[model samples]
Target: MELLVKSIALKSPLYTSVHLIIILASAILGFLAYKRNPNNPNNRSFLMLNLSLAVFVAVTYLSNLDLLSISTQIFINRLTFSIGFILVIVFFNFCLIFPEKETKKSFVYQLLIIACLGLAAFAAFFDWMAVEKVVSGLVTFRPRYPGIFRLFFYVYALFAFWGIGILYQKIRKLKGKERTRVQYVFLATLLYIIYIFSTNLIPAYFGRRFFIGHTALGAIVFVGLISYAVIKHRLMDIKLVLLRSLAYLTMLGSLAGAFIFFVYYLKVYYQQFVDPDIVFVLASFIAAFGFQPLRRLAEKTTDNLFFRSNYDFNEALSKLSAVLNHGVVVSKLTDDLLGELKAILKAQNGLFILSKDENKFLYCLAKNSKSVTIEELEREEDIIKLREAGLEVVVNIPDDDKCYGVLALGPKQSGESYSTRDLRLLEIIAPQITMAIKTAKSQEELIEKVIEERQRINQDAHDRIYNRLGAMAKLSEAAAAQSKDKELFEQLDSGLRQTVVDLQKIVNKDTATIKTNGKLASSLKKICQQHQKDYNQAVKYSFKASNMLNLDDMAWDIECILQECLNNAGKHSGAKKIRVNLAQNNGNLVLEVADNGKGIHNLDISNLPQEHLGINGIIDRVAKFQGIVDINSNNDGTKILVSIPLG
Candidate 1:
């Protein structure tokens, strides 16, 4: 115990430095692994492996320091051995599952791993593995002479070899990015194996420590290689990790070194002149004042050194904000925003998706990559490969309540992850994009409404009013020939012919403005009868005119809705019997149409596809009156109910 304290007081500089490096490297790697993907088994295994390595190195360092009592040292030694065994097990597990998971494993293989772990646990506590002793005011642990120690070494080696076999097998099966990941693991494992053999196996067998106890520091090299692999190969956006680490460590190291220099100078040159307490206070004040500034400077330097593309992120956002402040043309918005985001983010590919309907994307534009259609991307499971390829997924583009679109920016050109700043800027600008899209959609719908109104008037004039007028003219001419008083008949015929002309003129004028007060009920009845005659279907319809007021206001909407429903029933529903009911109730005009045919399934009326023109027209016409629609459908039949308030 006394010797242990002496060794700590006279701690080796090399030993202390090596211990710090090992500890820092292990912590950083483990943190990164867990942070990247906490739930992923592969990442978890990697974290565990790193933590075990840390424990192994830490205990070894503590035992060497000899600051603790003999019992404490022995306990630490046991922990070290136990962690070492656990490390190999974790590594083997990582090899089997990382990069890409292996789904199948034999029961025997699992039992073998368990058996190896049990043996390791036994070896960790058994004094036969290594026994502690003190000599020359220093504590040292001696392993069992070669022949016996070889058994434990061989077991660990066998497990390592199993991991190597798994890695080799995986390398053969994997391709592209996954293969690269496995290759990294293989290289890291190779270095670790070499380090263990040279530093540990050789020394224990030969009964001599190499490199004057500096050999243990070789573990840092192994940790570093693995860390490099994780940073460079597997995870794409480690720029944050690298930059933050560099900034903080550089700032800390500089401050610490400067303080040490100042203390040394003060002690050696001005011990008599300077008051030590005052100097300490001054140093504290300087450090406190300098901390933030130093950190900022270091952070800037790190960004400039490692992330040059980020320098213009703010500038890019400002430019985008300016562009999006104008008219909302969806196509223009998608095209422009996607291009800007691609440039700003330095991404290889991008997708701008806007809601075409309630359930699907209406439009998709791809920049700097092949265009993947919405149908192609609807399956979530299939896009995993694409995600790995740098798909920066952004969904519900505007806000949570309203998802106007989705934006997927591909991997950055420099293979960096999307920074928080970049995402924040995007979130900030999402509303502007959404407003623009809505405006564009509104403009489109208005134009379509105008065109449709004109077509309906022209078609209705030719099909209904014009034909009726022509038939009435012929009937009046025949009646004039049959009249006994030729003069009265001539006048009557002239008036009747003039009435037909007036009606034709009225039909050509704005159809909605044409009064439909007395005509709405009769018009609905005629439509139902005509549908029955046209399609040879049993169409039972009834219209109750009581309390139905101000019919002219809703006349156009009702006419269109009824026509569309009848047409759909005839053409699509394939029904033998159709029922139409029209009544005024609760200050609202109510219309219900039911059909005994195949029901509408998987239908979204808000975003109906192009082929359902009848249904689309019905919805559009009803919407003009701020009507409510309810559709009940099943395998047996379909029923539609529409209600438009009288107000």
Candidate 2:
């Protein structure tokens, strides 16, 4: 009789304990899902299902506790089963909408729910299914006509298997860690189904409960597995939820424990010891004073254990701001920014685009596998389409008229879409990036402008010096020719002739000219011979002329252009030889200057400064004459080809 009593006490705790654990775990999971995404109707429904399950389990456990009479037990059991049946039906629907799988078997799912409701109703109203009784001073339930309840169990088993199979198929198609989570859920559910079948069928077959503890153990294992998946895989940010819950729990636990201890000690001091309540009051005062500090300590410990890596959102934003201020290279800065964003938001992909032109955008940086090109996305139409489709394409263009660029970030990780907060973050960072690009462009333009101004000044100086020297020579000739006395005539003639010769030398500086009424070829030959001697380097000058071209502003410009070319070759190129050729090609004046010297390689004309005298002046003069200047150079030699359109 004692052994029987002990066995009953042990058996009574089993159902109550198992059900309580399930209720607690389910409540925790449901609360977390709801907290993370309050807008999701599926999450709300799942929370409802979990709450209903908890209530059903609690009532069943109370009935098992024998806190109520036999009739009450029967009523409670019926209610519990009804609630469980409803919860199971809701869970089936929740799975359907939550995972968002294809509903090929919708009719079958609805029919199963209907059948479960019918069975639950039958069991609740009639004794044909399950009967309640008092045996050995304990309330126990036994199936009167096992066939009806067995059918319900069989249907439950089938649905459970179907759910597991569906999840398995889905898992197979999924990639990465998400797949592993789904697979774990599948295994846990499979275990749960097996345990359910064994608890019902095995007990009924053997005429006694066999391995009843296994069902409780299985429930604990399944919930534990699910909790592991939620926290480890971050299925829904369950760690944060759990940490928050634990925070509240710690505070409540500490306060409740303190209050109870205070009241009990007060009672013991006053009633049992027959002492004044003063000592008890003093003790209570001390305990109450310690509550806040204790609460703080508990909070600190819990935070360290669970919320260790959790960073304040505002603090992270400040850190990001600091990073941006450092003026890092755009690519490296972008990579770091994206990495931080991915970690903070738990996103999958991030891309950044900067405006390249008024109508074009260049993808300056990308963090994830998002492919876009500057050439392809040149229109506003594509941008609008992307935004409409819910991509976070943050246009960095300011409200002011000067705005030009757009920044695009997109396709967050985990297939979960971006939120309003995400849009705001992108908006904030977009301006910073735009400002950086603008600063860089402005600096570049300033440098270019400085270059242009310097080049103009150098060319003006060269022109003024040449004009002044020519005027001085004309004045000296006029003064020398005006003298008339005999001694004065001889001296004046000699001096005048010398002055004229000096003036002629200035005009024919490059070569000696032959005086003739009309001899163009002879003049050309003389000019070519003069070029060979004037240039210290070995120069082969070849001249080919179609007609005697009339000298005009065009002729002076062409001569100046050739002089600039020769000056550059002599000063810059360490050449041993040169080739000067003048000809008429395609009704155009063509002058070719070639040198055997180290050539200009990879010359970036765009970045050339205004103070660059040699090349800049040559280019400016050629441009003024509407002429073409082609410069080709290699390690072997430099070649300057000048072509001016002539009639």
Candidate 3:
């Protein structure tokens, strides 16, 4: 009696547990597939495929839950089987769209998939494919009622093979990471298909009751391979996912092993006093409610024992990330990073060096070290030699087009090579370091540009406005000397008023007519029309609805720039017709102003003097927004193009 009870409890739940695990794993992968990138077509297709597989596993799991009523079990079985059956078509549909490839399958394939779905629906409604009666209030599969079970499986096989073949063809045409991703799916599909054939179909064909029916256990490998491809190749974050999976499995397996031992000892010690049935019930009760608390305890204990240092590493990086996100200045960022690296690597000294030109380390922040020289570390070979001499060195650029930096950590206090665990911690935070450096450089450049622009604006005021004021003083002295002459005095007064008006125009070129409702196009059009209507110049402009702009001061800068160009066209270029074009191109707002008039020669904007307020003002305004300006002038006309990032 004890042996029989043990065999039933262990063997039955074990197979159910395997299916449940696969179901949980597949569901997790499906959730991650969408969460990683909801907009990616490949992610969507992968999610659908995982959903189908999860449903299939869940249907298998439901077959072993003995607590449900017979009617409910029968209903659930039918519903889940129908879903699983339909998902076969879903899987094939996924294959047609996998890896972001949109290859349309043939007409025959579409018809076959629809026919398979219809047949599955028919089987689910009628008692043809699977029919069973309630026995002892428990539903169980009996014999088929003259249904096309073999035909259904055959159709499923046909679609699955066709999909796999399509995937293989797609794989053959791809290269690099794309080919690698498809290879993972193709291998998993091939392995699962072989397992199904060898374990379920071949044995049933030979008239055998095989235990290999639950070989869906191989789904663990399938989901694992797909997850690895996503994490290692696609760069989806699998850190928490992997940790939780490991922790949960470790806890569950440990508790299960403990329970098996508990059951064996209880049977030995209590079977004579209590009924074996009572002992089994007690064990089941313990397994039900005790698993969750036990898992939490085990997870805590495991973290303390094995992952304590990793916890510290992650915590440190998180704090450092917070500092980077805040408005930490570049000079302070280097110092903070140096301190963190020293603490994390447990090294006696650390160095943070940046190279604007990538030719030499011009900026250095070293903590507790003077042995290193910038000249020695400038060469790649020298850095390699240092890395060979038990020092860990990492070199990276903040962005692809900019300066690069290097981090070198001296030997640890314990004088041992850095562990793989330590290296992994460093690798995980390397990109964050690069991003922080990028932020620092951006902040520095903005400040520098602001200073340069201020100097240029001051110089413009000195040359154009202040110098005119000095001449006005001299003219006033001459007018005072000729006070008796009424005509000269009247002319001087009129000239002074006109000079005041011109100075007001230069200072107030950036009008406060900008909209707060993000209607940049309307404002631009208003400016264009005002110029045409007020000055009677033919000004034409074009814009699209998708070119909507809403940047604080950015749109204003662009407005001022366009206005300046139009003013130059109307007042100086002697142009009659001006064409203005505005559009959004690849995350940038682009504006082009073209005029049909006598063109100005030597139109290099960089060569424009401070006194040339028209072109100088345009350059200064664009520089403040990190914008680009190009001027082309010839005998035809002058065309000015300006581009500013929409952000």
Please list the Cα RMSD from the true structure of every candidate, rounded to 1 decimal place: 11.1, 14.9, 19.1
Model 3, C-alpha of 384: deviation from truth (Å): 34
lDDT of 2 at 541: 66
- Lowest-sum lDDT 10-residue window in model 2: 367-376
Clashes per candidate, residues 3 or more apart or on different chains: 2, 2, 0
* lDDT for residue 345 in candidate 2, whole number 0-100: 61
By TM-score, the better pick of 2 and 3 is 2
**Model 3, residue 319: what's the lDDT?**
70
TM-score of each model, paired residue for residue = 0.61, 0.49, 0.41
Model 1, range 521-603, lDDT digits (tens) per residue?
77788768755644568999888757544578667667667766776676677799999999888878899999998888997
Location of the lowest summed lDDT over 10 successive residues in candidate 1: 367-376
Ranking by TM-score: 1, 2, 3
Q: Write the per-residue lDDT of candidate 2 for residues 1-647, one digit (tens) a residue.
A: 55434533665475556777898988888877776556555457657756765665565554454434566556666665566566566656655554442345467667877888887686567754244455665666666666665675666656566666667777878888668777776776677667756774457544553222233345666677777776556454355446546666777687778777766766776666645466657667877787777666665665555432344657767766766665446666667766777677665555554445422422232222133321123234453455454453334534244444554555445543333234446556656765665665566678777785564444543532332233334444554675443443443344445436434544443222323333433444443443343334565667788766554445444544555555456556777777788787897778888988888787655466766655676776777667787888889978988887765
- Note the residue pairs that clash in candidate 2: 348-413, 451-610
How well does candidate 2 match the true structure in TM-score terms?
Answer: 0.49
